[model samples]
Target: MKSELRDLYQEVVIDHSKNPRNFRKPEGANRSAEGINPLCGDEITVHLKLAGDVIQDIGFQGAGCAISKASASMMTAALKNKTKAEAESLFERVHSMLTEGPKSSVNPEELGKLAALSGVWEFPVRVKCASLAWHTLRSALAGSGAPVSTE
Candidate 1:
């Protein structure tokens, strides 16, 4: 990442972490799942209202590290009105980015604000923090009752 882009991404991460979007349990949310990262004590619940496979609305409620919260916030924003397949594809992309570090094939520019998390791959432990919400979102979309855990 270029110096300026890194700085900008950092700023985006900080801003989202400080004031996460969709940080609530939205009304009429028909699907929900909980996630936890016991290593870092990050916990969250993702909620979604699907209208025939399209995400009609999305929200989350939780207390966690900046990365976790921001990821959830950005995820909700990115996923609203998207189909389940789209969300899952996005998750795969983001998951790859998180695990692959800067060498990941996915383009940061393509992720929009979510590209801010590009740097997180450098920190191994923080990856779990950042991914907790995403895994939970998958669980919610799958309508799974089991709680998610990053162990």
Candidate 2:
């Protein structure tokens, strides 16, 4: 059963990486962020169209390993239609799960298919790969002048 779960996770990761949804910027995007993993040269640019507190549309463009690309793809899908506050909360939840450790507080199902990335914690070197886009999103939302750095 564990092996089956692992296989399923791998498939999810691959599918998203290969055919990412919302992979192009929307016209006249009001907000944007660029994220890069210097180690592997993974680069992502996230574009957002906001309607007040709600995220009306979201998209991205990037090249990266399966993990980084897939995470960004899933993130764009998950955050669309979400309020700014909700997006922040979701980001915090996923960030804690990846950087800290999984805990009962995290709803496993709420991660949707992104739970596939749980394996990333075991591969310490790839943690940044998984988090690059997330940090970028946070910086974009916060309007921070500092570069997004998860490490």
Candidate 3:
């Protein structure tokens, strides 16, 4: 069982790093922001199309470690069609899980493939890698280019 979980994580990481969904600039994107991690030179641009409080579409473009790319891929997938409030809640859950080093407020099973990234907390340096896109998403939602400090 442990080996199976490890394999699942590896496969998810590979798939997202190789072929991340929503990885292109959106046409007429209403919200967008770019984020960078000086620690590892990871960069990402997050774009969003929102209808009222709901995210109609979400996309991202970035170059980073396997964790970063995979997290962004998982984020885009998890947030699609969700209300802005819902997305924010999800973001908080992920952030707390990664940064707080605790059991996530998010149900791991409900997070779908994103559950693969739960192990990232064990690697401190990689936490920023996993959050690059998330910070970008927050900036986009805030309508600012200000650097987001996740720490």
TM per model?
Answer: 0.93, 0.87, 0.86
Q: Which stretches of candidate 1 lie over 4 Å from their true place?
A: 1-9
What TM-score would you give candidate 3 relative to the actual structure?
A: 0.86
lDDT computed for candidate 3: 0.79
Q: What tens-digit string does per-residue lDDT give for candidate 3 at 51-130?
A: 78878889988688778888998899899889877887778878877776555566666667777777777777778888
Candidate 3 has its poorest 10 consecutive residues by lDDT at: 1-10
User: Per-residue alpha-carbon lDDT of model 2 for 78-139, expressed as tens digits?
Assistant: 89899999999988888776665555377656788777777676567777987888888877
Order the candidates by TM-score, highest first: 1, 2, 3
Tens-digit per-residue lDDT, 1-151, candidate 1: 7874464349778788899999888889899999999896778999899899999999999899778888888999999999999999999999998889778999988998898888888778788988999999999989977999999
Error of 2 at 86 (Å): 0.5
**CA lDDT, every prediction?**
0.88, 0.79, 0.79
Which candidate model has the greater lDDT, 1 or 2?
Answer: 1
Worst 10 residues of 1 by lDDT: 3-12
Which of the numbered candidates is closest to the native, going by highest TM-score?
Answer: 1
- Top candidate on lDDT is 1
